[model samples]
Structures are given as C-alpha cells and as structure tokens.
Target: MIVKPCIAVSAAVGLTSSALVGALHASGPGGLPRGARGTATRGGQGMEATGSGFDLGDWFKQAFTPQTAAAVKKKAGTSTAKKAKAPSGRGCTDAVLVLGGTGKTGQKVVEALLKQKRDVVVASRSKESAAELYDASTPGLFVQSGVDVRDEATLKNKALFDGVTQVVSALGPRFGEEGSSSEAVDFQGVQSAIEAAEAFLEQGDGSSAAPGDQERVLVAPGDSGSDERGPGGAWQPLDDVIMGGRSSSAWQKGVGGGVLERQSGKTFGRWAGTLVTEGGGFCGTVIKDMPFDATGYDGIRIRVRGDGSRYKFRLKPDTKLDNTAERQYQAPFDTVKGEWIEVDLPFESFVAVKRNYVDFNAPRVNEGPAGGKMLSLGLVLSRFGFNEYPNPKYTAGAFQLDLMEISLYKKPRPNFVLVSSASAERYHRLTEEERKNDIPIVALNPGGILNWKYKAETSLRKSSLRHCVVRATGLIAEGKEGDESVRLQMGQGDTLSGRVSREEVGSTVAAALSSSYSAGKTFELRRDEAEDATGKTPDFTSLFRGLVLDEDRSLASAGGASLPLPPFAIVQDPPPPVTEERKQEILNDPRVKARTAASKKPE
Candidate 1:
C-alpha cells in the first residue's frame, strides 16, 4: 500500500513502520520472544541480552517497588535540600513558559493553565504587553520580559528556564507580516527552545526518570491571590447614595445601589431607583483602582436579576472621577428581572461613549496595554424611565437590578493541544501556479514544510517526552452554514481533504498534548462531514484511540489474551539445550530454516 511506503519514511525516523519493521524485533507480527535465542547454556537456559537495554527484572523491580518519600530522599542524600532552596530573592516557580503568550491560541493556553491553578510565566518581547494580554488578577501569572525565542542570547540565559519545566512554543509569525517570519520564529526559534531545554537538562539538573523532576519547584494558585476575595475587599459602595442625581436630574425622586449578602457567602447588589418624570439617569456605585489586574481577560462578566429593564454597563478607563461619560466604554444589556442571568460583555463589543452620547464612528474600544487598565466599573440606568419603559404603568416606580458575581473570563483554553498541520501529500502535487510563483514551496518541493515539520516530529518520537503529532488538511474557525460538530477523520496516507475550525484545531492540539494515549503516534486530521456539524465536540477518546501506538497495534494484531504489564519482560530466560535427536528434528523443520535464514541478514 502507498501508506505503508510513506509510513516507512516516517517510521525510519523513530515512528512505527509496517509489520515488516516489527519483524526485526521478535517472531511474527507480535514480536514475541521465543526460546531466548543466542543465550549461553548452563544447566538450564541463561538470561540473554536483546541489545534493547530492556532488562526485564530491573523493569519489574522499578515498577513494583514503589519509591516512597524516604527512598527518594535517601537516593538524593542532602542534594534534595540544596535543590529545594532557591537562591535568596529569586521569585521563581516550576512554571510553564508560554512563548507568544499574547497570540490568540497562546493566550488561551495561558488561561487554561491559570484555570488549573498551575503556575505560569509568560515570555514575550515586552513583559508589560504580555501582562496586559493575560489576567494579572490570576495569581499565578508572571511575566518574563525581553524573551525573544529566536535570539540565542535569550535562549542561552541560564536563569531563563530556572523554574520552567514545560516550554510550549505557540510561536509563529503574524499573518502576512514582515518581521518574525516563519523561518525565524517557527523554525529557528523552535530549534533554539529545544536546544536550550537540552542544555538546561545537561548542565542544571541531572536526568531522573521520575514523572515530574523533583528539582522543579511549583507554586499553587491558592498560594497566590486568585481564590481570595471578600466584601469590602474589591467591590466598594458608591458616593451620594442616590441614583438620578448622579446620571441626571430629570426625576424628582431617585434610587440607590448597595450590596446584599446571602447566607451562602454569595452577595447580590441592591439597585432601587424611582423616577418621577419622563426620564432619569442613575449610575451605580463605582469601584476604583481595583486591586486585581485584568490583563489578557476577554471581557467583564456580570450575573444579575432585574425587573425586565434594559440597562447599560459602563467602564471608565484611567480615571476614578464619578459620573464621567467622556472616554467611557459602554455596552447595553437587558435584564430578566426575576431570575439571575450571566452576561458576558467582551471588550470588542464595548463602544466609546463621550458626553452622554454614543460615538458610533469611534474605533473599537482599545484593549491595548494601557487600554486594559480600568479605573472604575459601574451600572447605569440611563433613559430607562421614559424612553425605554414609557408605559407609566412600569415607568415611575422603583426599578431594581440585582447583581451577583462580577468578574472577567476568557475563552476557555483546552488542556492539551494538537496542531492540525498541512498534510505532506499536498506538497507532492504542485499546480501550474504553484510551480510558477511559489518559490519557497518549489524549493521545499515534493515535500515542502512537511519535511521540516516531520523532522521535528521525528525528534519528539525519539525523545522520552510525551507528545502527539496531528496532520490536518486545512483549518478554519467557522464552519460553513449548517455544519456544527467538528468531525475527525483519520488516515495514514494524508490524502484526505477539507477544512476545520481554527477553534477545533487549537482544541485538538490541546487535547493531544494532554492525552497519554496520544504519545508516540501520528494522525491525519480532517473534518469534512457536514451532517453532525453543530459545533459539538467529537468523542476525543475514541478519536485518539484510533491513533494507537505501534506497540498497541502489534499487540492488537497478535490476537490473544492481553499481555501482562511489567514483571512482563521482553528478553526471557533461555530454553534448555536441545538433544541431538531434537536438534536434528528442529533443523529438519522448514520454518526454523526460514527464521534462521532471515536472522542472518546484516542489520
């Protein structure tokens, strides 16, 4: 099959080839060791080495003999103490350094780590910009300034990875941009990160086969400030205590907004305002100089219950002065009145409102570094009495808007990531236009970037690090109309065609990164089926199960009782020496001659 030949090229570089390659390991497709061939004979068969360094007995001992804390401490002697004590005044934790943390997918990855409460360090050219792109309110966020992955100097900085264990490179050049081209960032930068990791492992910490190396110290979120908040802590009360007079003086009577506490530690806001005339404007109590930094978060989220009234949520940037309309960003929201509902107001959805009038022509509210530094947040009840609820029946009395939790959220990032890359097959067939204009494509011809990417994949496969490689046809964020669920079609030949959401692509990358089963395997990813495309996530477990490891494929094809794990060794004790009569019979067997002949070929 064409796939078998293609698989051979990939498998040669540490991936799994066809059953033909498995033949080199043992007998038949299963590669089962038989009679422990070539062992020295004693009274009985002696144990033989298979040159794989696979010591069965040692494997069992390591697997069954659990290493208790005492055992680990004893093994390290006093070196463990020295490792635990970081240099005085060094603020570092076992962090996952996310390069390109301000990018779309990069930011999401950071958010996911924060959600897991894992310590994270964002590495970018500007730490300030990176911080603005992340939720500084999230306790574990630390910014590493002046980190250009392509720069060898930065990569060689010994302290760069001081507490870093995992380094995720979402590094890619911005589309159609000049500086930071793919050759520089994606190719060379990735190589630099890998080399730096290797150097760090060699010089800074010795390799130990433990799950997470003991030398890497990590900080928990609770240890930071993320999970801590209370009344009088972040939220504060408004001045004047009256509503209409603050926003406008159109009404004879007014309303007030304050906090109400529930027995379960949940607090709701109390907004009761009365408008006597045609119209009234009331703005709620404002919060100033919020202790938390909301960098990187998408927008503010509020849970509220109101009297079915239309309300406006306003945010003031750079100033704490009350009732200021100029330079304020506002988004209108409707309340359900009786039942509490959560509303997400993304930063992009907000518009600038100056001098109590909307500026429709103003640019999208800036969310840049300085733009995200919000000075105040409050609720506005502008135009609610006459313009909105003009029926007089529901217009004049007290209007209430209850507020529950108010915080910020970003699009949740997937735990694992598997980039859906362009298939190697595409490069095999060059169009007339491709041949004429695509110099880079032609230069990398017949293979293109696929070869470069596969080279990286081969490195990963050869390494002990756990990883997954997903080859995708094309990626799009939004599917064509009527398509909802992200479909996963797997093939080895890379002949599949279609596009999938950038969302699904990012999600798949995240999924593959986290799945143990995905390690040491490659997959062709596509999502062409339009029937089940309701934006539903496909069954990832089953999808990943299809990309079984080579070892797993071999075992499945062997078709017998499941092999027992550890204590289950590869190289077995040699069998007893055959008698002259038995040896004569074995020598006469045709299968033995074939096996013997096959083994004699130079490896």
Candidate 2:
C-alpha cells in the first residue's frame, strides 16, 4: 500500500532501511502499508501486534518488495553512461611515467600526455581499475600497476621505468588511510620518486656528463680543414670598414704568443682588431659560404684568450633575401687579458640585430625558420650592446683575441616535473572570509597537506637534478561548461586564486619537460574568469620565457615580489642616433651598392 510505495522511492535514492522507517513514521499511522494495527505487549514494552502498533516484520517485507527492486534497478541504469574515447597515436620516442594515473586529476594528465604523442606509463595500485578506466589497446599508452610510492622498492624497480625520460608525480594523499597518510604519500613518496627518476636518467644514457664532453664538436682545436662537423669556409674579415667605419680587424692561424702558447703547443685562430669610433664603433671577422646545422644542440661554446675586452659572437642565417639587410643573432661575452677561458652562449641568449639596432620582433637564435641552418659566424669587438645600450668595456684601442675551439653543447632536460598544489602557500595566508569561500582550502588545510608538500618541494629544490614545480590552483574537472570559457593565467608570489581545468595542468607539465626556460623555476598556475578562452593554442614559449628564475634577485627580498610585468608592458628606450653624414656614407659605400645591385638582378 502507501508504505510499499514509500520504500520504493527511498530505496531508489539509496536510503537505508532505518531511514525508510523514519520516513514511514513521519507519514501518519493512517498511511501505513497492508499490515493490521498491532496490540501485542511484552513485559513493560509495547510490541507491534498486527493492526495496533508499528511492526518491523511488515516493514522489512515492504522494503524489499518487487516494486522497490525495480525502482533501484532503473536508477542504476540511468546513472551509467558511455565512457569517453581514448587517444590514438604512434609510439613515442621518449616515455613519460605518470604517478597516480588512476586518480581524477592524474587521468587528465595522462590524457594530455597521450594527445601530445608522448609514450605514457600509468602507475596504479590496481591493474584492473586502470584497465577499466583506459583503453588498453591505445598506442603510446601503457598501464603498470602495483606502484605504491610508499614502498621505495616498488619505485626503484627498473622494469617499471625502463624507457622513461621524465616523471610527472601527480600523487595525492589518501586521508584516514593507515599506511597512506599525508606525510607518507605526499612528502616521502614524492621524494622517493625523484630519487629513482634521477638515477634512471643519469645512469641510463650518460646525460649527466659535463656539457660538450660527449657532444658533437663543430670546430676543433688545431684544425682548419673541413670535416663532417666543421665549417666549410675559411675565416675572413667583415669589419665595420664595409659601412665606412675606420675600425679594422684581421684573422690569422698562429697562437699570437701569450697564455695560449704557454698552455698548449696547438695552433689556434687569432683575431686582432683596432677600434675607431669616428664613423662606426665595431670590428669583426666573418666566415661565409659554410653552412652549419645546429638542430639538436643547445648552444655554442668557444675557448678564447682576449685583451680584457667585451666582444660579440654572431651567427648569420641562410635566408632567401640574403642581399637585403638580414638581421644577425648576437650575444656578448667578456674575456680576461691574456687568460684563456671558455665561454658558453646559449642559443636563447642571442638577440636579433641589424646595423647595431636590436629587432625585438624577430625570433631568438634558437627559434624561427632559419634558426636551425646557420650560414656564417662572426666575432666582433663592438662599442654597443643590445637595445642601443653602450658597451661598458669598449675602448678605442688595439684588441687581440685567440680562439682555440668552437663547438655546440646540449644541456640535459629536466628529470622530474612535480604537480603540486598552490594551496601549499596560500592556505595559511588566506583571510577568514577567503577561507570560508574556498571549499578545497578549508578541507585540505586541516589535514596538514600543505606542510607535507612544502617538505617535498624543498627536497626537490635542493637536489642536483634539473627540476620544475608547477603549483596548480583549485583543479576543476573536465567538461565543466562554466570553466571551459575561462583562460589560463600564471603568476608568482602565490598571489593568484581561481579555478583551472585539470587537463590544462597536464599540458603545462608536458610543456615544461622539453623547455630549458622552465628549468629551475616555480610559479603558480590558475584560470582567469575575466578573460574568455580562445581557440588558438597557447604560446607556451612566451609563457615560460616570462617567468623569473628561482634565484632571481626579486624573489630573494623580504615578503617576496610580484610577477614581472609582461614584455609589451615595459617602455622601450629609443635607438641610438645616427647623423645624416654618416648615414649617407653608409648608403653610398661600395659594399652596399654592390649588394643592392645584386638583389635587384635576383632570380
């Protein structure tokens, strides 16, 4: 009767039998099911006797009736939905191991990695659970279970991380679990994973060797003849004289007798120049007709001895519009008088310049279409730095520089990429009102998750391996219609607060692994509700480039510092002034005339 119908409604919503009884009691006695009124009594207690009082026997009978079972089955069927499709791609060259891959956030990370065409290994405690969650047949994705971070032995198993070059620790703590507490899983577990990953990367392929030790040598000492890796053109002069400047320079093959001869009997190139600041203030030697492709290398390294003067090293790209004034990428380095030293010039440090003026719009030396194929190399003693800044060490005198070797070197990629919480820093700093408004912060703070995360981060920072820490704020689940319209925002000083989709966090982690700019940096990541999300892909290069390194002076001060303003936000200084007479002389020069005529007669 009415009681049976009430039981079906309660059971459909997953209510317990005790709750059903309470529901029936709230309905009047006149609304009871098909049981008679009870009148039974035992000792001092009144019992359910037929039609007189409440009867437990009749209640149980009504709760599990056929109608109640059908309602429960219908509810379960409605709740089940079709699973999303898994990513498909070819096997990846480099494998990335994802810890806690079965967790809500971890699955998003795995999905993002798969979309990036990276081989992904999901570490889980239950193989069956991971199998049910993901398509086992998908290429570039492998599931490895029994990976408990608490057990160092499990993490240390070599087979589990065989081809893994990077590790993304998405592990979160399991509260109230005996063995998987915050300290055990968050701090100690992450520390163990880092150690294991470092050992695997270093010992696997000798990536930890000194820079240029096992690398390809583009130019070797005591050799001028062309080899497979050396330049094909002979060293020549391309000084400011071409632009009507009185500055002059020469290149020769002997040691030129100084600390260089004393250290080695090997022959080296000598670049000696005289600076004349009257017309132009630069001198340089150039090597043309030689194409050098620096595809896999990170930067150039040169061994030189100089007269305590600052000089610029430049690379000219092979472009179709060669007759035009193509910008060259240049970076400055200083040398000690008569002392031979090696200088490292990373490709990212070089800026594009034409006629002593920097072109901020041009791509860096390591980027753009022609960046990989370089046509010429130049060594210049310049009176100017980037953006029209005067070089402090410039002097109008003779300068002698000795070059022993020139080669390309690669720095190792990050070994560990940790996905931590932004709340680790903001939880304690939030006001009472802020705390009340944020549910995640309120729930995570009392569990001491922040303390454990801080400990893990400190260990990672102190470790020798290259690392990146991405602290995400308020991770929102995928398919949140309200969140999809927001854009991603990154900041420092823990000052940003908002929701970010878990998928975006995974994409950020994948981007950080291959970027040298991301190494040794920690910043907060969130989404901006004010800005609408766009269809265009994010410029991760610019995003990583904008972040300040951990050792930057701004972050060392008390209370820390706010994020630096964007590159476009800063005011640019004016270019150095050029008089009409000097400009006319440069335009009328024989070199300029010949180049113009050649370009006009082009293909």
**lDDT (tens digit, per residue) of candidate 2 on 120-187:** 55555544444444566665455545567778897877665554556667776433233554567678
Which residue window of length 10 is worst by lDDT in model 1?
4-13
The regions of model 1 sitting more than 4 angstroms off are: 1-94, 115-117, 174-179, 201-420, 425-451, 462-464, 477-493, 533-535, 550-603
Regions more than 4 Å wrong, model 2:
1-94, 102-104, 111-117, 123-139, 145-153, 173-184, 198-215, 223-233, 255-267, 320-325, 354-356, 386-390, 426-446, 459-466, 480-496, 527-603
lDDT of 1 by residue, 218-317 (tens): 1111112233222334444442235334332111112222335452345444556563443234434445554334544556777777788777676776
Model 1 vs truth, CA RMSD: 21.7
Deviation from native of the Cα of residue 538 in model 1, angstroms? 3.2
Model 2 reaches what TM-score against the true structure?
Answer: 0.64
Tell me each candidate's RMSD, in Å, in order.
Answer: 21.7, 22.9
Task: Give the distance in Å from residue 331's predicted Cα in candidate 2 to where it truly belongs.
Answer: 1.6
Shift of residue 132 alpha carbon in model 1, Å: 5.1
Give Cα-based local distance difference scores for all models.
0.42, 0.56
